[model samples]
Target: MTELRNPVIRGFAPDPSLVRVGDLYYLANSSFEWFPTIPIHRSRDLAHWEYAGHVEGAAPGGSLAGVPDSGGIWAPSLSWDGERFWVVYSIVRSVGTPYFDADTYVSTAPDVSGPWSPPRRVPSHGFDPALHHEEGRLWLLNLQNDHRPGGRRFAGIVATELDRETLTPVGTTHLLLQHDRLVEGPKLLKRNGWYVLVLAEGGTGFEHGVRVARSRNLTGPYELDERPLMTARDDPEWPLQKAGHAELVETPEGEWFLSHLAARPLKTPEGPRCPLGRETAIQAVTWDAEGWPRLRQGNARPTITVEVPDAEPPAFWGAGNCARSPHPPAPDNAPPYYTLRSPAAPSWTDPTSRPGRLRLRGHHGPDSLWSHHLLARRITEHHTEAQVTLQANPTTFTQSAGLLLWYNTAAYYALDLTWAEPEGEAQHGQQWQHTGRTVLALTTRDENETRRAAVQEVDADTPLTLGVTVHRAEAQFWYLTDGTRTPVGPALDFTRLSDDHGTRLRFTGAMAAIHAVDLVDASFTADFTDFRVICTSV
Candidate 1:
């Protein structure tokens, strides 16, 4: 058997929706706020996964500007019905408020990798929507939210018929299941003349888990299973905690597997800190004597390793789980380039402008929700090194371009190469004429407070190399000095970028970015190349 590592798709990849098309398996996950919404990954062995593509035009106007963190696309439900693949998701605008303040949309593609249709708006009953196809009929499943005083946030599971042609609701929505304990992210299927409903129960935290229910009818009372399908909530020492938000799929060999969201929390004095965010994990499943799904025998909770059929590993493997694999190397699935919120502003960013370089025109900076000239990739591992080479000579302090570790507008760290004059002698317009030298600087922003450190000064004529090594909850900056690399600045707290740290809710994790800004005049430009993130376990 081929030993498969858990968290097949790691880092910030939460709320997974799995589907099997022919011999290939394609899965989609929630991409909140960040553009290039609804990232999809494919695999053959269900263990080694690779990035396929994402639902590109899932947002209106190609932008989700002003949407709060964790408030854009949430819990995409990916499914296939004979010819095309269908994806349904919700765009949450207001979080933590009584009202969900969300809009649901649906899109389809002939293949997993786009040519996806522009998203069509549907009813927004709540969040975590799913699309199910059964016996040639289409249905939409979502969790109804109660925003009123003294009402439960997760009211119940609801379902409605949707036209296959237009994706509009056919009739009134019906309540499927109600629970005293929390339940949502409902995925439905049919097996042995029974309609099965799997749900994410409790919250998506340490108390998270998977619950099961079954019914003989499509829309009716669902009897809760005698036992939970899978969970790690009760086991504090479990490596894979927050084991919930799951979907199940069948292999060509008729084997069953469960794809779910889990987190690897580090034991800190303050408590357990999940710096890597919720990740995607898989568990081998089997039907019990009574038809309820159960994890592998002898395993009550999720494990780090699983065994697959002793065959060729999955065709599509992302970054190839080198942390524990004993096999041939797979082509690195380190995301292809980066994604932008707005369409690549031809004036701001263009790959064809400079050969072998991604040139970006500095604009609104990283804090601007509307117009940001930022290009970034998701930080998929906690212990990772993100580095980039920049070719830019900022004549003024207003013009700066460098590497950024971004986690929304408030929390981030950057190593920018910008012009710096001797304190009071530094004038904006006169910077070009002054003796201001180029300096590699470090800046950290926690909440609304910002701190800066001038790491080292260098000649502006030479290209500068900058990088950051992240070890779990701390990040240390590095810069090329003389001929050797040297560390700079204190180890910044990486955990502060998590969803639980900020004043408001933060649904997303950290991302490595490269941005340039010309606050004074948009005259200066920066050329960035060789941007890479190497994932390693320390």
Candidate 2:
């Protein structure tokens, strides 16, 4: 027996689509506006998983330059039909509006890390589109959105058969099921001559849950399940919140398990905050005499630990023995770093320019949608420390570069090396004009306003080490100079960088990043080295 901890895949990995191809299991998760769009992971015993590769060029033209936050890729569904793997997802252009303005596409590859086929546009009924391959025929499942006034945005779940060659609609579109509550992320499987449709009920929030419906025929009036297969909505104090969007895969020995997304919230003064965003979790599944799938424990709530069949402990695991894999690490040539709104192209971001260092040419400010030169990695733990050595000389106020804790354009905190004028004594009735001094500025941005939290003068000639430490909901920024590390700012409210704090629509998780901005000209370049991030579960 293997002890499986909850959140088998940790941090920022949400809306998991799991599939088993023979003995190896492959999983894919959504990458909304970040490049290296769809991240794929592989597991051998279902207890230990490793980062195999990502769906290269998943983003159209290798860029999502102007995509709105949380509005690029939503609920990508991965499947295998004997030969190749297929990925279907929706790219939402407009968020927080009635008109999602979404486009769905499909791409196939012989292997997960592939020379994938160019994404061909598919029929888009709404976001969270999924593909079902049956009897050599492909079907598309999606939510039908009614955009008219007073109409339901989540009108119903619809399925349409697609022509394998042209990838177009062929047969009649069938309405699978409808409910008063929100339902999306439909996954189908056949069991005992019954076609079961697994659904993500409610929105992706505290009220999230997993519900099921089944029909005897491929397309029909489906019967909604009496109870949810799994949820934490009724249990507010449960460690895992917002559990839904699940997919199931059976092992070679016929044991079944479900993969879903859940969030771990930090207890705060006002409320709970989920800084890490939604993560992937697995639950054992079993069928009853009535043929409905239920949790192995016969309970609807999610557990922190589950036992599985046939597994061995890995040589290394994450803090708390949670979800790090023990497989041999990927080659050093390919690092797991992501860039915003664009690919890591040599035009703006180059790694070979400075040999051991990464060179980033300053582009637009962090608030810009077109081109923001940011290199980021997902924050995978509640307690983390990240540091980087930066070599940048910004002579003007318009040029700055530094470390960033980014959630979105509206919410973030940055400790930057920039130019600021210092106060000086002047002659009687005359003002003294002095060159601006290089200063370390800690700034915070939210929906209300952007304000400087602290500032300190620093020597401009020497390379500087900037670091941030986050423990639970609080964060502190620091800098190293002359072999001494000193705190640069007050303890910040890291809880503000969460999906529950603001009123805007946000889906992605927190990220520790290094960025540069040259609002005047895109010529200022910053070289960064010795970038490291260490995270542990609290």
Which candidate leads in lDDT? 2
User: Per-candidate TM vs. native?
Assistant: 0.91, 0.95
State the lDDT of candidate 1 residue by residue for 1-538, as single tens digits: 6777878777778899999998888889888877667888877777767667788799888888777656788999999998999999999988779897989999999987788999998878899999889888899999999898998889999999998888888989999999999999999999998889999998888888999999999897899986788889778998999899889898888888899998888776667877677888888899988888899864558888887765455543334332221111123222244444554555433435565577888888767766778877666666888888888988778889999888878888989988888656635567657777778889888887887854577766867788988888788888776867788778888777775575777667777788998886677789887877777755
Q: lDDT score, residue 345, model 2? A: 62
Q: Supply the TM-score for candidate 1.
A: 0.91
- After superposition, the stretches of candidate 2 with alpha carbons farther than 4 Å from their true spots are 311-332, 347-353, 424-434
Q: Each candidate: what lDDT? A: 0.80, 0.85
Q: Which residue pairs collide in model 1, if any?
A: 49-318
Candidate 1: where are CA atoms >4 Å away? 314-335, 343-352, 424-437, 453-455
State candidate 2's TM-score. 0.95
Clashes of 1: 1
